[model samples]
Target: MKKILILFLSIVIFSCKKEEKGFSDYLRSLDTLVLPQKFSLNSTMNSSNKYDSILFKKYKHRWTYAPYGIAFNNERIVGIIEYSIADNGLAPFLITFDNNGNKIDSLNILGNSSFGMKGQTLESAILDTNLKLVVIDSSKSWQVDIDANKIPNTTKLRVSTTIYKIQKNGKIKKIK
Candidate 1:
């Protein structure tokens, strides 16, 4: 009986000791990350800041607009800009500039409903290993219902995602 008690207590103490390091401790143990070199813009950039904001058409409706993402290839920098039109969720556009910051082309991606449905929103975008652009467009709808405990619970939350690929010639292709 004494040996069994000692073994059980030892096992409990050992188990507790094994969990000494948690997520926070693990994070502290990692070395600081080194970031890549910053991009330098020339006189052609127009604005002195590294990031330039281009405004869209203004309206009295409840709407929001922002510069979403930016990526650079061998010779050009690409920016994804988004705007909201009240009942319509998000509309995104792509603009390209040369290395010297001169405007190369500006393409509106929402006119024909090719990127997503008429009212869906664009969430984010990033450049892939091949320098091709990968974009995420999403829409979400939710419903609440009463549970057995008389509490309102989210019974359904529908989320849809779309991935697009941007080619070198400034064409948008839905790949997923």
Candidate 2:
């Protein structure tokens, strides 16, 4: 019975993840991730403080929009974006663009802490066939919040989450 209770609680906690509401919700998440499809190499990247060239659109503003890793499916260009706000930290975006600068699809995935709580600072991301996202969090174990009752904190545990199946509807299904 103890094992059964634990299993039941696990299911409950896992199932509590939010779901995508509708087209509007999905669209809002993807809007910030739109990118150029046919991108040329950056000849002037990392030149100087006043960098010149047209390959990168990122600047040292209040936030950073950058790419960590990218995956390609056949000819489709799939890119992962790591955007960090002023004091908030980094957020991940899974995006796919067509050959004509059109966005095929995008997924705005949030980072989770080792405490199993939702947070930020996603380091890298990769998308599979079903749009399932494999994310790596850069937040160290000490970054996760801890409280009483949630006793015996895993000081050695790090923030990491691997989502199994990303439904066509833009919902993430986490796998153990």
**Model 2, residue 154: displacement in angstroms?**
18
In candidate 2, position 125 carries an lDDT of 53
Candidate 2 segments exceeding 4 Å error: 1-53, 58-64, 85-88, 111-131, 134-176
Measured on C-alpha atoms, candidate 2 has an lDDT of 0.40
Top-scoring candidate (lDDT): 2
lDDT score at residue 152, model 1, on the 0-100 scale: 39
TM per candidate: 0.33, 0.33
How many pairs in model 1 have backbone atoms within 3 A of each other, for residues 3 or more apart or on separate chains, i.e. clashes? 0
Q: For residues 80-168, what per-residue lDDT tens digits would candidate 2 score against the true structure?
A: 34333322334444454443334555555543422234322434554554455665565633333354333235544356655555444
Model 2: residue 120 alpha-carbon error in angstroms: 11
